[model samples]
Target: VDADTPSACVVEREASTYSGNRGDAPNLRGPKRSKPDASSISQEEPQGGATPVGNRESLGQAGINPVHSPGPAGTGSQPVGQEAKELLLFACGVCSKRYMCNSKLVIHKRSHTGERPFQCNVCERCFMQLSDLRVHQRIHTGEKPYTCDVCHKRFNRRFSLKCHKRSHTGEKPYKCKECKKVFTYRKNLNEHKLIHSGEKPYQCSKCSRAFRRPETLKYHQKTHPETTAPRECEG
Candidate 1:
C-alpha cells in the first residue's frame, strides 16, 4: 500500500446479514469488500479514528477542514495547494494568529512584546526578525536586488518593486472611504484620510503650529529655524 494512502482505504470485512429462514449456522464467512480507489481518496490528514477519507461531512463534524498554508520562502507568487498539507496549529498567545511552524510563532510573539533581537552593526538599529535586519543592512550596502522589468528601476525590497509595477500599470488599489479618491500607494491613502478626519497630528515644536501632514509641518519649521525652545500647540 502507498504511504500516501489513507488507512480507511484498506479493505475491511463486511458483517454478513442473516436470512429470515430457519437457523442456518450463522454464516461464519463475511462478504469480501473491494479496496477503494486511491485516486478518489482525499489527501487530508484524518482526525480521530479510521473515518473514510474524502468525506467532507465527517471532517466538518470533527471540525477539521482542509486549509492552505504558505509554503517555504521564495516559493514564488502562486498560492500553495491544500493537498496533503497540515494546517497552521501553532498560535500566538497575544493575537491568536496561527503559524505552521513553532519558530514562526516565536518570531510573531516579538511583535507584541516589542522585542528586537537582531541588530545592525553599522547604524545600531534593531529588528525583530533576522530577515528584516538583513534587509535594513541594504541601506549601508546600497544593494538593490529587485528591479523593474518595464522601467528598469531598482528597489532594495521586492515589495517596493511590486508597488512600482502598479504605477506603470496605472493600478490604484487603495481608495479613500470618504470621497472615493484612489491612490497607487497605501501611504497616500493614509495621508488623504487626515484631510477627512481634520486631525493635525504633526505640530511645529518652535511655533506651536499644527499641520495635517508631517511634510507640511517640516516645511513650516523653516521660517522659525532660529527658535530653539519647543512650545505646545494651541487647541
Candidate 2:
C-alpha cells in the first residue's frame, strides 16, 4: 500500500506443511502474507522526492493518459480519449445504425422522425441536415457544381450528373425480370414492368378504354373526340 514499496504480484501461494512422524525436512517458510499496516503505509513517501513510477506505469497500462500529456492532433479543445470513446457509443434508436458522434445520430434520426430542423430562409423549405439545406439553397442561387463530361451540361446535384453520364456510357443497368428488356433509367424499367402485368393504370375519362402508358391514353382520346360535330344534329 506504500507508494515507495515495490509493486506486488497478485498470485495465490500454497502453505507448506510437514508431517511430524516422517523425517521429511520441514519447510522453512509457510506462505505468510504480511498485510501492510495502514499507519506505516500512510507515513511512507517516495525516497528521492520524485514522483512514484508505480502509479504512472499502472495508469499507462490501464489506458489512462496523463493530464499534462499533449492531446492528439486536430482534436481541437476536446479530450482525445473521451472523443474516441464517444465516437463508438452513439447509435440510432430506430434502425440501430451506429454513428461517430451524438450530433450525427441526431441528424440521422430525422429520417425516421420526419424532423426537419434546418430551413431555407428564402424558400421556407425544410431539410433534415444542414448539408441538404445548403444544397437546396443552390436552387435559388442557380449554383451548379456538377457537370457532364460528354454533353458539358451542368446540374446542381451530383445524382443528376451521374444519370446524365449514362447517356454517353449507354449503361442499361436496369433490366426487366419478366421480359428481360433493358432500360437506361429505373423509371422506364418500372413502366416496362406494367406491360408484363397488363396493368392499365391510365384510363380514358370519356370512355372505358384504358392504357398502360398515359401518352397512349392521350392519343386514344383523340379517336373518340366526344363526337363534337353537333352530335349529327340529333339525326
Candidate 3:
C-alpha cells in the first residue's frame, strides 16, 4: 500500500511471509495446494502455529496501528479503514506467518524442507518448483528480482521484495523515551541514546581513542599514523 496507510505498517505487501527452499527435492513434485480464501487477511497466525492468526496480541498491538499519527502540529491520525489491498496465501507446513494472496502460498511452498525437484542447466541450484528456479537463475544472469514501488533500491531476493516501509512512512516505532528522537532503524535508536549519556562503548587500541560505532574508531585510528604522535610531540 501507499504511505497513506497506517503509521507502523512495518512489513510490506509482498514480504508479509517468507518463501524459502523447502529443502526436499523428491517430494517437490507433490500435488499442488489450493489458494487461500480472500477474506483471510489478518494478523499472521504465528511461526509455530501456536495461537491462531486472530488471537495474536503483538501483531495487532505493534503492527498496523489503528489510530492516526501525530504530524508536525495538531494533525490527527490518518483515518482508519485506509489499507492497501494485499494478496493472500496458505502455508500448510504448520508455520505461524500468513500470506496476503493465494498465488503467494504456491510460490512459498518451494522453500520448505529442500524441495527443489527442478534443475537449471546454467546454474546447479535445484528449485523446489519451476517459477522459483526461474527467479533464481536470474541471479546468475544478474536480474533484478524485484523493484521497489518507491526509491531507487533494487534487490535480488524477493524476501527483500518490499522496500523498507519506514523509509516512506517515516514511522519510527522504536523511540528513545529519554530524548524522544525517532529512528528508522532499531539499532540507530539504540546508538542515538548513547549520545545523551555520552557513552562510547567501542574503542580503538592504536590511538587509545573512542567512538560510538566501531567503524568510526577504525577511521580515527588511520589519522593517528598520518599525524605526528601527540604523546611524542608533547614530550
Candidate 2 lDDT = 0.79
**Model 3: per-residue lDDT, tens digit, 1-235?**
6677654544442233332433433343588877767555343455664545456465466554446533467564543432322222344465644567656665566566556678888867687677778777876888885777778677777655542656787767788889687777777888898898999999877756688987787778777664555565563
Q: What does the lDDT come to for candidate 3?
A: 0.65
List the candidate numbers ranked by TM-score, top first. Answer: 1, 2, 3
Cα lDDT tens digits, model 2, 61-132, are 656677767777997775577566666777777888877778988888889999999999998999998889
Q: What value does the lDDT take at residue 182 in candidate 3? A: 76
- What RMSD does each model have against the real structure? 23.3, 21.2, 38.4
Residue 194 in candidate 1, Cα distance off native in Å: 1.5
Candidates' lDDT values, in order?
A: 0.81, 0.79, 0.65
TM-score, prediction 2: 0.44
Pairs with backbone N, CA or C atoms under 3 Å apart (clashes), candidate 1: none
Candidate 2: how large is its RMSD?
21.2
Output the TM-score of candidate 3: 0.33
**Which digits, one per residue and each the tens of the lDDT, describe model 1 over residues 1-235?**
7788656524232222234332753545687677767664556455568777657688778777657544569867644555323377787877778888999999989989899999999999999999999899999999999999998999999999999999889999999988999999999899899998898889878767899878888889887747457888999
Sort order, lDDT high to low:
1, 2, 3
- Could you tell me which 10 consecutive residues in candidate 1 have the lowest summed lDDT? 9-18
What TM-score does each of the candidates earn? Answer: 0.58, 0.44, 0.33
